[model samples]
Target: MPQPVLSLDALRALDAIARKGSFAAAAEALYKVPSALSYTIAKLEQDLGVQLFDRSRQRAQLTSAGLLLLEQGRELLQASQRLEEQVRQLDSGWEQRLRIVVDTIMPWAPLWQLSADFTALERFTRLQFSEQVMAGTWEALLRDRCDMALGLAGEGVNAQVELHLLGYAEFAFAVPPTHPLAQRVATTPDEPVRREELLAFTAVVVADSAAEMPGRDSGLFAAGHVLQVPTMQAKIAAQLAGIGVGFLPVHLIQQELLTQQLVVLTTEIPRAPVPLYLGWRKDVVTGQACRWWREHLLNLPWQQLLTPGELKAHV
Candidate 1:
């Protein structure tokens, strides 16, 4: 007998079933009836003369042979997608998708508005957003995981990377109005708090998003306790609740400062204004969608992108 020839549809059925975990779910995703999907998988298994999924499990799970095939099949599918995308790009210069990695410190409202405007252009490019903190922003761009990076902290000096200065943002050591630090600052307005006093309280810091890479500490005591949260918003909330005190981007908490909800603490070591940059890989040719986004961001004033507050006056 001749060797079995696999069809793309059959491979897709296997993938969908594996991805969705059940034939019923996969059928819904593929816009097919459950029975049809089941028949397709059965036919594929019969043709290959091997069991793709173990019948005992409630969820569609791949056997060792199935796992091997699925791994290679995904690569083949991805290559096919790339080929199609390239052809489409040749015909119309718009990219199929654009991935942007942004630092969580940046305000989201303006970015969302910009994305809405981009969508209005009808360029048919999908926008993917990933939030990264500190070094993770740089790492995402270097690893080719993102097409563009916004609000990056430091200079990435490499021939393959292109960097542009966004602006500088000042960070303040803010504490809740009811906190001891705030009360002390209110009473002793002229004196700076000692490091030991500051260390006595827990520091609220945003946990770095980097995987496998070493994370950086922005404004936490070296020997003190910390309450690590996933996002910058959570950090601010923790600080507002008097859970912990740490450095926060001034623009992010301007409203709270104006309302005296959060008070700034004068510390022995005042953090210098951090400079942010926009970075993209120089190696990859900037696609139409990416170029459009870059131009749009470059034209936007940094002050307008941040949360509206009297940060400059406070700093």
Candidate 2:
């Protein structure tokens, strides 16, 4: 007998089934009937002469062999997709998809209007958005996970990417009015709280979004206990609940400051404003769609883009 040959269609069927959880669901995704997938996968199994999915489970759980095949198969599928996308860009100036990653500190509502404006152009490009915190923004760009990064922060950006400064943002050390820090500031309004005193209390900080690489700590000291939250919003919530104290973006907590839901505590040394940037990989071809997005984002006012709209409403 000859060795088994794998077809793209069969691989697609295998991928869809594994991802979608069941044959019926995969069929729906592939726009084919359940029977068709079952038949195709069955034929593949016959050709390979090995079990892929364990039949004993209710869901289409892959066997060890199937998982191995899938791991490689997904890479092939992704390459094929990239090839197709490149072809589309060559034929037309627009990319089929543009991935945009924004720092969590950046407010996304402004882009909602811009997205609607882009649709008016009738460009075939699709917009995808992701939010990253601190070093995670840089990591996403370095990992080739995103086409464009907005509000990216840190020291000098990587040489591989073109960087544009959006603006600088100031952070305020905020805590609930009932917290000791608040009382300290209120009693001695002129004096800034020392680092030792600040570190003695728990710090609420946003967890960095990077997965493979170790993420950097943004605001906390080595000696202090930390309350880690996934996003800036969560950190704000933690601070408002008086769980911990740390510097938060001033623009983000305007409403909280106004309503006294959270109050600013002066620190011994104020944090210097962080410079936010817009960046994209230097080597990757910048298609028209990507350029359009980059230009549009760069044109927006940084303060306006970062400010939470309902600062009138507190935590």
Candidate 3:
């Protein structure tokens, strides 16, 4: 009699073993006991008539046959995931579950309102927000882990992805109220301040993946005199302490600007406004819930959200 084919559950068990390097780890990841996982793997090997793992060592290692099986297993898993994604997308309209990723810098109030509008349309609608940096958002969209993403336009934005420009936000050179720029009138397009004027001041910049600084090569800001801080909130605190002048999102500083805690630099250099894009995979079909949220964002009057001066301060 011929051996039976391996089951999807068996393939999953083997793949998990390969990924986790031990039966115990795989079992934990799969929410199964080690013995159960071992039994599944043993059954799989029996069906294939070949040993999938070298059981001699403390950690499970893939045999040559195991390696070959692993490659095929991964392909099968990916196909299964894709199929499930398609089915989920088709049926998601009635389910009310919407997964979305947004840039960390995106305003929270507007997003809350967007969610409220979506839920009002369908009370069962649910929103999941994944906070990621510029590049990570695109990755989430491509992986089908998220239905939509909002982020700044960047080079890695795939051509296969669809991007909608929500609006442009100006970048402003901000400093404490006591800073020299605080005393001067805001800079205009024709009279933009020279880079040399900024060099004399210290610049506190956000560091690491959390930071949303503009592309360095874009000539949007001077790169040499930067003091790298970790988070946007920390950068703001540094500015308040009068440590340095850093480029900040205009909307984020609205309260500071009004209370005289922060002041915008006056320069002829045009405010470098970064265009924000709402991105989604071009090939993925969105459900009604996703469509409703997208249209809600498109219809938002962003102009009314911030003052004209605040908008120009950053761009």
Residue-wise C-alpha lDDT for candidate 1, range 244-301, written one tens digit per residue: 8888998888779889888777778788877788889888987789999999888888
Clashing pairs in 2: 255-311
lDDT tens digits, residue span 38-128, model 2: 9999998888888898999666679999998899988988988877766876588887888999898877677898899998986667789
**Which 10-residue window in model 3 sums to the lowest lDDT?**
210-219
TM-score of 3: 0.56
Q: Write the per-residue lDDT of candidate 3 for residues 36-130, one digit (tens) a residue.
A: 99999888888778998888987668899999989998899888886676566556554446898876556767888667766676345567887
Total clashing pairs in model 3: 16
Minimal lDDT window, size 10, model 2: 306-315
Error of 1 at 140 (Å): 0.8
- Per-residue lDDT of 155 in model 2: 67
Better of 2 and 3 by TM-score: 2
Candidate 2, superposed: residue stretches over 4 Å from native? 1-90, 303-315
Among these predicted structures, which one has the highest TM-score? Answer: 1
Ranking by lDDT: 2, 1, 3
